[model samples]
Target: MKKEFRSGCPISSTLDVIGDKWSLLIIRDMLIKHKKTFKEISDSDESIAPSILSARLKLLESYKLISKIKIPKNKKENIYLLTEKGIRLTPIIIEFSLWGDTNMREFNKIKDVKGLNLDKSYIIQSVQDHYNSMLLNF
Candidate 1:
């Protein structure tokens, strides 16, 4: 579907899709936290409402950032995974993590991104590699 954009600016266009907090959090759960199921994502620290969660998941799927599927044996359950396009947001998530780690500490307690001991590129690559491994197994 062609989406209506408020402006042609890159950042604005990107935000038009993932601008909402729930959408970004949903992506975070899939990418960094490895939460694939509806229950798992809804049970996130943010405690998103079921209705909102369902809507955001559908929106993300519509944007081709994520994909939903059901296992052959369990047609009743749905598993959502980040597509390659979605995986591209890994670096953005990491950037947010790093920014929060540096600037948000005085206001709130936020954990550093996993593998803080390594370089930023390594952390991003490790996350992408882990997700790819899971995809391969699935």
Candidate 2:
């Protein structure tokens, strides 16, 4: 069984849903690159197993972070899409990607992002604004 999340703090609650390394990576794959199908997710260089990816998708869906829909062209296969909650994570994911590109020898692309001195406050505000826009559009 999955561990229960702490409820009082919103940050804690947010982490409870996606604190795991895989979950965030999955979210990154979806939000950053707009990967939709299970095949695309499984094909990630991260090499996540299908079963683990399935479980993570289920968990994110349960938390209302993402949803799946059948593609009109290929109705048999489902494409996972981020809900408002998932879209709200955009800036944070970008920041983490920026951090990884800077510190990790493997991720060198962030030199530009770091050089730009991406504003953390601006990212946070963007996320809030994006979520607000999503909610209102509904």
Top-scoring candidate (TM-score):
1
Q: Alpha-carbon error at 62 in model 1, in Å? A: 0.6
TM-score of 2: 0.73
lDDT per residue for candidate 1 within 98-129, as digits (tens), equals: 87887898999775555765799999999999
TM-score of 1: 0.94
Using all chains and alpha carbons, the TM-scores for the candidates as numbered come to: 0.94, 0.73
Clash numbers, per candidate: 0, 0
Question: Model 1: residues >4 Å from true position, as ranges?
Answer: none
Native RMSD of candidate 1 (Å): 1.4
lDDT of 1 at 70: 96
How many Å off is the CA of 63 in candidate 1?
A: 0.6
Question: Against the true structure, what is every candidate's RMSD?
Answer: 1.4, 4.5
lDDT of 2 by residue, 41-135 (tens): 88887899989999999999988889888888887999888888788787778778666766784644333443325577776675556545644
